[model samples]
Target: MADPLALTPKSSYAELPLRIVSAILIAPPAVAAIWLGTPYIEMVVLAAVFMMAVEWARLVGHDRNPWLIGAMTAGAPQPVIGYFFGGFDIAAILTAILFLAMLVMAKIAKLPRGLWLAAGIPVIVLPAISLLFIRNDPMGVQTALWLVAVIAATDIGAYFSGRTIGGPKLAPRISPKKTWAGLIGGMLSAALVGTATILLIGEGDIPLIAVVSAIMAVVAQMGDLSESAVKRHFGVKDSGAIIPGHGGLFDRLDGFITSLPTIALATALSGASVLQWH
Candidate 1:
């Protein structure tokens, strides 16, 4: 591991404040949507689905094909949106069809990154579905808030600590800016968030909540690293320039991309709200 005190690059510091400001702007709207539930949250998911799908498609396939590549990814969101009114069977069918169709289209087009292009479907769709899943829970709004807090805390903690601690890189090949200290800091931060959440609820096992949040921090980092790896593979810097400071929807929401699906699955399997860590 690189020494924790070692100073790193200066570029991050230059953009740090802008990043924070941008996040502040985006958070309230998202939180409101999550709190409102039904059509409101559905609209947020749809917007995210559109942006993230376009960004992913643009990244992997648009190098040469541009609009056509983006068009191919359009089918993914339909199934997720269908789940809101049409139920799971409709969603499953659309997802399978789109998933296979992307690959087939890529193969026909002889795209070098056919796999990557097809991956955009799951990458974009699953989380939208998961967001809906969480939102539909009786305790949905609170659960979503807790999940978002955990992810945001992880990202914020990691961003600052990685710069401040300047330690050995975590997955340097995938994301050179990430550090072991940042990972630890993020886990610790999320653990704190979890503890605070339990306290605010006025009950629950603190240590368990802390541990789960820490694990989720790791998951969010994994999502961040995975997005970085994809960008690296494509030789692209930032997914898109949509957000002034945050790159694109994908760049900002990558943690949610992975964490949502995982948490949703956990909720399904455990028969419990994520907020109820106890």
Candidate 2:
């Protein structure tokens, strides 16, 4: 999420060095895990979930309460999800339980923004659950890879387009850096990459997948914007300082929080992998 693409009107050459170094260090391992699938993917999901929970609690609660940490830890549902990662039903049930547990923990911690503190449980956790569930699906590898590609393309497209075009802001108040040109660039990029992914995999409804990819690109941007709104509301600059140039795990994955859950739910209701969406 934190990239040189949107730091200023044009691509920030000054920040390019750090961004490149960070991407080199982080992206390879992540791409490999998604490519590998199974236990490796689960490890990625769990690590991200835990980090996001901690960051989210701190951002909203603005406190260092040990109880909040405990709630964030419990809200992650590690062993429960770790052992049952293969089962979507187990994840769903665990999600509900964890949601309630976080709410209660929020009350117990007596954080000033208790309700916002509780909201992070689901927001930070659902994508992790979705990734786990989707990775265990019949077309797990292909589906997972396509989702990644589409999202990556969206980010790349938005970054380059927004900087290059330097158009009017998409939502001046929510995220002044974002532009309409960037959104369209992201949608177009998602459509092409998503359809190309289906072509490469030799499966799925290409036209529909293209359309969905474009829509999900919008969803991803919306997710990013929502996160911006949240940050603005809280008067925070970055979510946390975990990743070198990426601010935090939450900052890195703010978009996925929305897009992953949307696709997972759609894929689930369709009773098929995205490859079989037709």
Candidate 3:
């Protein structure tokens, strides 16, 4: 029987060039920033998060007034910046107050879809905070690289595996293209990448690294699915036309946004050197 989920050979052939080109253009700078760490990665995360806020606003109909959307986007990174100066406890409190105030204001203004308008806070702030925290750790650069490797492997594996061995859809209603085979492939690839990264960086528990990597891969897929759900709810095809084949920064970084916070949390709780895992 024909595989209903499979993309036509011709269609796959047509998209391959564009996908490859887009990946080539995007991967180098991102990897460079991860390697450099600190201020550079911080800046990159801030800009990307702000762009994601803009895209979210646009999707949820909050961008009709350019100035309002612009202000909101510009302000999205304030909490993370606060973290830099005021520390996490104070920054967390301030962020909560700020988000509450924004929500109250949205209600007062009778904004359309006030809930989603409020959602723009965590959508940008949490991940920005997470990335900043992770990159500020003692073994920050290595930790960041491990994250990048896992995410990259998951995305690459899913893309190729899904395209080549398409079968049952993972979530037909949310993202029709994702498949069970692709999910398994992504998890396996993430595990492999994590193991390799740990070994390359020095000694570590390979089993623990693989387990963590697999969990992250699953979370990344969940993040992607959540974003897809949002887009579908808004009745839009893409978040924005910024990236050539990727749609928008949000579209590209959705998995990262979700994964970073979890990684950061685990790193903190475990109190292990993320690089050494010791």
Candidate 4:
């Protein structure tokens, strides 16, 4: 697909300024919520998840009425709420039931894009729930901060390195601009930020943090590429115009959506403090 920004010529680089401004506006409040914990974080997560659902629906060609979009978005948070009240078991059951109901509803209503709609449940809810789980842990604050830092470092490093190097494409078919250099740069940056953050503020084996950070960096990039594939499949440039330059909440949070759940699962299985080595 052709680059959307390229079509505008004069405004091709306009996205950079808008992206910077949006990040400045969003980061502070997000950090505050992570620090504040619970209700605040939960609310913020729900809101983001809802927006992502809407954007997902829009990307899949379901843009008739705003109410229908809103209804589709509503399902993303149900499982998260279930997890909060009942635990993972209940959350799992709820997710299954919800998925089946959505499939049936789509079939009955004859929604053309039912599969993607059904997919929104797990795609959006799992990460949101993972974030909640991480933030509710004893070392919640540190873990949340670590996750944010790693993601930010990965994105920033990849952006600059890819632009500067501009060599081989990481995945030419999916995201032409991404490069192997960018991937390595992102992983290194994540390792550095994650290792330093845990060492200074919390406790952990530095090597373990570095390794996990590197892995999460790769996962985050994969998340980005996956989103890009979705856009390419639908032949749309941006998911939505919700964020000035960032495209949409999904565009902005795709990395977090994938990485958080992976990290959360790692933490769960290892029984380690997210900031500390087992």
Candidate 5:
């Protein structure tokens, strides 16, 4: 094991109050959409999906392929919109269009054929599917809020815990700064927050919320690590510095991307209609 002491430290969490303030300012409008159920949540999520798609393109050296990237950004939100308003029909059209464009671009760029599929599909599918999942529930806003809380709590807790305790690396190869102490601390904090949030809402199924949030915390971490692995593979930092301290949309939402699917799956299995909660 390499000495943690020897590792080059990056920016401390305290040094980024501006980034924190910016995130706080940015979150409320999106939260209000779900809280108010304005049908604009889909639009907001779509824009985020578009931003992430563009970031993915840049990550893969498609920065110059503005047209291709634009098509992808536009295509990603269609499936989510289709989930509620158009079902699969419009989504299919959008996917087909994006795929055709990818094929043309791949041939022209002479890039590895698999790169297009690997990068494009996730950018298009994940957020769109997440939107669909959110739409299935009546409390989509609250659910979305809960998801955000889970990811944020995990991140914030892990950051503080890691800083305070500062022990063994969780995955030194993928994320040099992440520590086992931080991971455990983060999970505990997420569970506490989940439990508290459920209680505050006075929900009937507190156990369900706690269990799901705990599980989602693990899943969210897995998602974060997965993105870190991607960045590590490419030898880059932050995926793009679009959100000031937050890196890119992908960086900010990576945890939600993975956990949203898990929530959707659980909701389906339980035959629970979301948005109907007390």
Candidate 6:
């Protein structure tokens, strides 16, 4: 059996330049995510989430029900969307209701029967909901930028770190490509990004932001691993070959799903500078 982490062109070096190019392409939207304000950012993010849900459903062997994916992505992001159109309470309640209703539907749906449906609901909601906390914060836009920076750092750091170090596997069962060295490399990368942002970026709570970024890095990797587990269970590789180098939107956003919720919760609980309370 060939090593999964043998630095293949298709999976490794080939992706380096593409990833750099992708970063260059992505920077504008990411900047806009903050400069453009919460509503527009939320809208784009929700749209991406909707698309990912549809792709994820197909990848998970649920070819019979495309509408379920539609319902999930549409309904899940409704709460976040509601915040822009209505208010936070309304948006949260609507999404919660939709989730509850979906829970019942998932239980009742006798076809294929699995926990993923239930899991998917929260996975969709958490990141969207996290945005609310982010939007409400005084440093919301900066916070959003920092959050994105942390995840990006992890991705970039892990790639180089893993490639350079190349040691033991992290979780070979779920993600054969991941290595322990890579995990550490990713975390350290996030830490460096966090520290740099804190020292250089003229925004956010330095210590708090660094801590949050570090935590998010781990969570992001966990999210990636979780998504990998889901894909493995379904015997699929890449949610979809949508991006030239990247797999799919779901594959791209997997880390964000985990990191966003953690950032939201931390911001809410810590009374961090990220949030402005009256």
TM-score of each model, in listed order: 0.92, 0.89, 0.91, 0.91, 0.83, 0.84
Evaluate model 4: give its TM-score.
0.91
Instruction: Write the residue-wise lDDT of candidate 6 on 222-264 in tens digits.
Output: 8888888888888977786555746776777788788777877
Error of 4 at 73 (Å): 2.4
Candidate 4 has its poorest 10 consecutive residues by lDDT at 1-10
lDDT of 1 by residue, 69-187 (tens): 56554676788877977876778788888888878877887867778877787788888888888888877777789889998888777767777777677877777777788888889
Clash list (residue pairs), candidate 3: none
Task: Give candidate 6's total backbone clashes.
Answer: 0
Q: Please identify model 2 stretches exceeding 4 Å from their true place.
A: 3-13, 78-86
Candidate 5 regions exceeding 4 Å error are: 1-12, 15-19, 88-105, 113-118, 273-278
Q: What is the C-alpha lDDT profile of model 3 across 134-164, one tens digit per residue?
A: 8778887788778888987888777777777
Give the Cα lDDT of each candidate.
0.78, 0.74, 0.75, 0.78, 0.66, 0.69
- List candidate 4 stretches off by more than 4 Å: 1-15, 65-67
- Per-residue CA lDDT of candidate 2, range 1-278, in tens? 54313434655546545555655765677778888886787777777778777888777854478777776766675533744634666666766777777667657766477778767777876787787677777887678778878877888888877787767778888887778888888889999997898788887889999998999888888788888889889988788886554577667677788988887897789878876777
* Candidate 1 vs candidate 6, lDDT winner: 1
Count clashing residue pairs in model 2: 0
Off by over 4 Å in 3: 1-13
Model 4: per-residue Cα lDDT over 1-278, one tens digit each: 11211111122244456667667867888899999987899888888778777887888888775755876777777887888799888888988888888789889888887887788788888888888888877887888888888988888777666656656778888877677877888889999997798669757778878988899899988788888888888898888776654577777777887898887897798776567774
Judging by lDDT, tell me the better candidate of 2 and 5.
Answer: 2
Alpha carbon deviation, residue 40, candidate 3 (Å): 1.6
